[model samples]
Target: MTTPLVEMLDIDKSFPGVRALSRACFELLPGEVHALMGENGAGKSTLMKILSGVYTRDGGTVKLDGKPVEITSPRQALDAGISIIHQELALMRDLTVAQNIFIGREPRRFGILDEAALNRDARAIFAQMNLKLEPTVRVETLTIAKQQMVEIAKALSYRSRVLIMDEPTAALNDAEIAELFAIINQLKSEGVGIVYISHKMDEIKRISDRVTVMRDGEYVGTVPAADTPIDTIISMMVGRTLSNETAAITDTSRNPVALEVRNLRRGRDIRDVSFELRRGEILGFAGLMGAGRTEVARAIFGADRREGGEIWVGGKRVGISSPQDAVAAGIGYLSEDRKLFGLATGLDVRNNIALASLARFTRAAGVLDDAGMHQAAEKYIRQLSIKTPSDTQEARLLSGGNQQKVVIAKWLLRDCDILIFDEPTRGIDVGAKSEIYRLLNQLAADGKAIIVISSELPEILRLSHRIAVMCEGRLTGILPGGASQEEIMRLATLREPAMEVRHAG
Candidate 1:
């Protein structure tokens, strides 16, 4: 039997209030793609961080080529032929491709930067990858797919034999994904081992040779990817079988219009977008990336100033110049980048939950009623099934799903009648996604109008009463629930005038 490229055994790691990993183990063979599958807090990333030398493991035995070695820093790991490409690319956008790739290890002649040698070295790496990218072009000028290729090229520049990719396709379109897969195949043929960390199920089946499952900081099991069913793998990762049923298309046509937008416009981001969201309905916004779905949401929520548009709340035309005004009109927006715009990570869960409704807990003497805030937080934590040790726990300590639930709790506490959830389950796992879907359904059933903007077509099909498709900042068409993926894609790519805007009677 050939020696394994990497082997980890009995990995244990802990933080201030969390045991991130416990007796976790993983292995990768040369020329193999091993997938690390788990939920948000399942310790997959922590284990990988230890391997990449970003964090020192409390206890573990790691072997490369059947010999144990201690890797305590990223530099050490790089020297040992290991490299990590994070989901958020780390390239310097202002620098040229060659400069960004060889930033620290630039070729220098008598202490002067050797620009010619640097570009030559970068071009050599690109040629090895069969990638076509100008070494002199600024990193910012390239598309995300190209930037990702640059990241991969940087990894190979280190002559790395083991590469770890975390959610590499999260931001990539289908064509870009195909391109990335081709590169992965080429690398595999070169006897390089890869540890692919992704929540996307289909991707695991398509690219990985083996699957390792982790749950709640412990190793669950590992199985051959081609032999194991997706549902079985999901069950292993989440410890239960999640319902695969699509949501029943509820007839909300008779419901009153809770919100309406007429000619909503933002510089090229949004173009004369018009739609009416009825009470007790989930209106899904679907499009390719940069189709202006988020732009329309931001304009409606007053997070961005609209150049021209009319917004009506409860049949009354309202001037919403700022988020405060939108909030006053009973509108709440859950931003796609929740950590940046939704929750204060450093604050306790209780305070974060009550952030939007702080006034409700304020006393006449200008003092905050802490007990009232705690009670409200506790109520929603239970109502939303947020898994936290207590309401006083720091928001950042919770898993991605729990953090999202906290954001929802905040808006619910604010008593907003119209909700805009942008990418509600972007980074969440399968189990958490089911929970969020249930919550959104319950919210809509309770008469709160909802607009969900998602890059995923399945999510839109699963939850929306009406699927609204967009293309190039235009509302191209609205299809009924259960519409085929082909129909949605056609509208998503269509640039011409949309099919007649249909309003529910």
Candidate 2:
């Protein structure tokens, strides 16, 4: 066998309270795309960070081209011919494409930047890659896909012998993904070892040469991508099999509609969309990325304005000019970007729990009733089984799933009957996801109308009573629960369907 390009053995690293990685072993060979697969908190990112010198390993041996070496900083990693493209694009929006690609080392003529030469060099590199994007375009004006390409192009410019891509296709659509894969194939052909990090099962199967699995900061094993089934991989990541079971809700059509949205429009993202949520019904809103599902949620929540729309809550038309209005009208909207809009990450558990309904805890002379607040927070902590060191633990210190539980507790305290859960299980673990699913089921059973919007098809199939797939700001189709993945994919792809739904089982 040929010597491996890179090898990290028995890597152990830890943070203040988290043992991020233990005995993790990873090896990559030249001309191969090795996939690092795990759940969100599965230590994949931490392991890679250690490899790239962003985090130093307390115990491990790293080999470069069969020689053991210690990389202590990002500069040292780059000097060792290693480059990482982070999941979050880090380009400066004010800078031009060429400026962004070569920000640290600008081309200088007589100690002054030569604009013409910069563009010429950038254009030459882009031409070699068959990319047609203009070198002079501002980074802010470019789309997410184009910005990601620039990151890759910059990494290539480093003449990096090893490349790392973390969730490269998270923001990209089908065409953009194909282009990225083509580039990866070209890189592989040139014997540049690649390490792909992603949670997406399909992408791993499609592009990976070998697969490594990690669970709870521990390395499981490595296997051939072609031989391991997705279910097996998921099991290795989460310590159990994932249930893609579609559960049925008994006859929600007989129930009265609790929330009705008519002709909802918000800029170009959402247009002329309409839907109804029946009491005790879990309505699944399905769509591809950038398909306006989230826009509808934001407009309904009054987080964003709508050009045209009418919202009716429990047979009464209501004005939702702001999020407060929506809340007063008994509606709860959970933004998909939870860290940005959902919970108060800075506050403690008890405070964040009572945040949405502080008025209910107010006593004589406008003073907060500590006893009442504590009771309410305790009730939710026990009911939701929230994991925390104590009731006073900071919300930001909790794991992603626990923080989400706190958000749910916030809305439940508000006593809102109409709940809109946008990507509720995003970045959540499989076990926690099952718990959230059960909570949603119980809420619907208690007659609170629910609308769930998700990008994951299997999740929609499993939890929804009715599936409403959207494409290009229009309703594509509405199907019954237990719909096959193929059925949802068909409706999801239809740009202009002749009928409301295709007849499929």
Candidate 3:
């Protein structure tokens, strides 16, 4: 048998208070696409980081081409023919594409930079990848898909033998994904070993030769992608067969409308959009990336200004000019980027939860009532099953799922009945996803109106009582709960031409 191109054995990594990886193992062969599969926080990324020299493993052995070598830094790893493209692009946006690709190693002569040589070299790399891009084009001017291609080009410029891509398709559309797959195939044909990491099941089955599952920082197993069923792979990742059974159908039509938006218009992103959230109903907003689901949610929550729209709450129209006004009107929004918008990471859990409702715990002299704040925080911490060492623990110390719960707890403390959760379970593990789903269901049963915006079709189908499908900033259609994926996708891709034809008739 040919020697594996890359091998990792008994890898272990740890951070303060967290053992991120334990005895993790992986192997990749030339001309094969090996997929690393796991839930969030399952140590897949940690193991990859160790291999790419982003993090030093406490204990492990890495072999490349039948030879063992120590990679102490990213530069060493790159010099040793390994390159990693992180989920988040690390390019300097202000620089040109050629400059970004040849950064830190620009061709020079007598202390003078060789601009012509740099562009010529970058253009050659682009041509090798069958990409049509101008080397002199500024990186900031390119679309996200184009930027991602640039990242791949940068990796190839190193003449890397082993390439690692993390969540390469998370933000791409169908056409863009097809283009990316073409590049992957080209690399595979050239005998470059590729390690692909993603959470999308269909993509794994389509692109990978083998799939390796990890659970709680431990290697679960590796199997041929063709032989392992997706359900089986998921079971291995989470240690249980997650039920595909949809939530029981509940009749919420009789419930009064808790919130309503009519003809919401916001430049080009939101146009003539309308939706209603009834008490005791989970109204799901479903669409592809940039399909205006988030825009509609933000407009309703007053996080973004709407040029023309009317919002009604509890059978009366209300003016919400800002987030504060929305909160005062009993509406709460959990942003998709929670670290930036939702919580104060530096503050303790108790303080974050009480931040929105501080007035409730303040005395007449304007002093904060610590006892009252702690009591309220503790009540919700237990009520929501938030796993925190204590209320005094910093919010940033908690896991992704726990941090999300803290956000939910904060809004609940504000006595808000209308909640909008955008990508609520993103970056959370499978176990924590189940918990968040249960919590959402419970909140709906308790008569709170809920709106969930998700890119994942399964999530939209499972949690929504009614799914609202958007396309190009318009409400194209609404489907009953448990609708098939095909139906939802059809509506999600519906365009203005179809609507115009129907209206013309």
Candidate 4:
């Protein structure tokens, strides 16, 4: 039998009020990609954190090359050939790529910073990875994909034999994802062991060698990624089967037009985009990165200035030049970066849910109606099936799925007839994704117009009543529900003005 590269046995961890991990265990062999999968709060991250020394394990035996080792801090873990790249990249935007690669341990000569040595080392690493990034370029100048590569290079700088990557491709486009996969293959060839953590089942099937399933802070089982069916793996993760059914395409042509945009323009980010969203419909916006889907959403929500456009709400052309104006016009936008725009992370769930309609909860002399706010918060919390101890729990304490629910509840309370959800399930788990899908369909059934913007083509296909594709900031074409993925990709890649923008009912 081959000696395992890493062995974590009987790991246990706990926070102030929650048991994060319980008797969890994992193993990794050299040159293998092991996928760690679970829903939010399922202890996958906790287990990895223990391995990477971000959190000290309460009870566990960590072995390297069959020899027990104690890892008490991140520095010790790095010295032990372990490193982790989190979902949120930790590179300094103002620093150069080379500088970011060797941040604290820069090459020094005669008490002076050795820029030449730093660049030379970074260049060598990029060459080894077959990447064409400039070492001298500022980190902020690079795209999210390039920044992720920089993070990988930084991990390699530590001579890390064990690398833990969390949701590495959450923000990457197809081309970028392919490039990252190539780098992973190169690393595997060099005898590195990778712990790949992501909620994307397709990616797991493609890149992982073995899949380990965790649920509610306990180990479930491990299976061969290539041989195992995705549905089986999902069942292992969530302890139940989730429906993979596509959205039922209902006829909403007779419904009133809830939102209409004509000739919307905002530089090259958005160009002459037009669409009509009817009540009781879910219109999905599908496109590649930089295709202006989110840009169009922001323009319509008045988050960004539109050079030229007309926005009509409920048969009236509404002047929306700001988010406040959009909200007053019965439009609500849930941004892709929910923490940055949608929710006040520091506030409790009750306050965050009532944020959009605070006036309704306010009384004489600006006194808040605490009872009403609590009742409203509890109502949505129960209706949305949000898993939380109480409405008083801090928003930051909730998982990504619950945070998204809070944002939705906020808009629902605000009584917005038109809701534009940008990447609503970006970082959520498979089970949470199902819940979000069900909620969206329920909202549409209740006569709410919704616009869903997603990079994943399957998601667009799964929930869209009618799919709208964009290319280079222009509306390429709109396909009916149940359109083939190939059909959507063709329009997504069409750079020229080939098809006139129209809603295909």
Q: Which one wins on TM-score?
A: 4
Pick by TM-score: 1 or 4, better one: 4
Q: Rank the candidate models, highest TM-score first.
A: 4, 1, 3, 2
lDDT score, candidate 3, position 93? 95
What would the per-residue lDDT of candidate 1 be over residues 1-505, giving only the tens digit for each residue? Answer: 9899999999999887778899999999999999998988898888988999999999989999999989999999999999998765788999999998887999999999999999999999888777788999999998666887898888878878999998887666787688789989988999999999988898999999999999999999999999999989998988877866555687777889999999999988898888889999999999887889988999998999999999999999999999999999999999876777999999999999999888889998889999999999999989888877789999977876678889989999998999999988876778888878988888887889999988788899999999988899998888888888998898899996455643432
Q: Evaluate model 1: give its lDDT.
A: 0.89
Give the C-alpha lDDT of model 4. Answer: 0.90
* TM-score per candidate, chains pooled: 0.91, 0.85, 0.85, 0.95
Model 4 scores worst on lDDT over the 10 consecutive residues at 496-505
Q: RMSD in Å for candidate 2, one decimal? A: 3.7
- Output the number of the lDDT-best candidate: 4
Greater-lDDT candidate between 2 and 3:
3
Each candidate's number of clashing pairs is 0, 0, 0, 0
Model 3 agreement with the true structure over 1-505: per-residue lDDT tens digits:
9899999999998776678889999999999999998876678777888999999889979999978878889999999889998765788999999999999999997889999999999999988877889999999998666888899889989988899998877556677788789989988999999999987888899999999999878999999999988888888888875644445567677899999888899998998987678999998888877789888888888888999989999999999989989998999999886876899999999999999999999998899999999999999999877867689989976766678889989988997899999989765656667778887888888999999998888899899988888888888887778788997888888875244322210
Enumerate residue pairs that collide in model 1: none
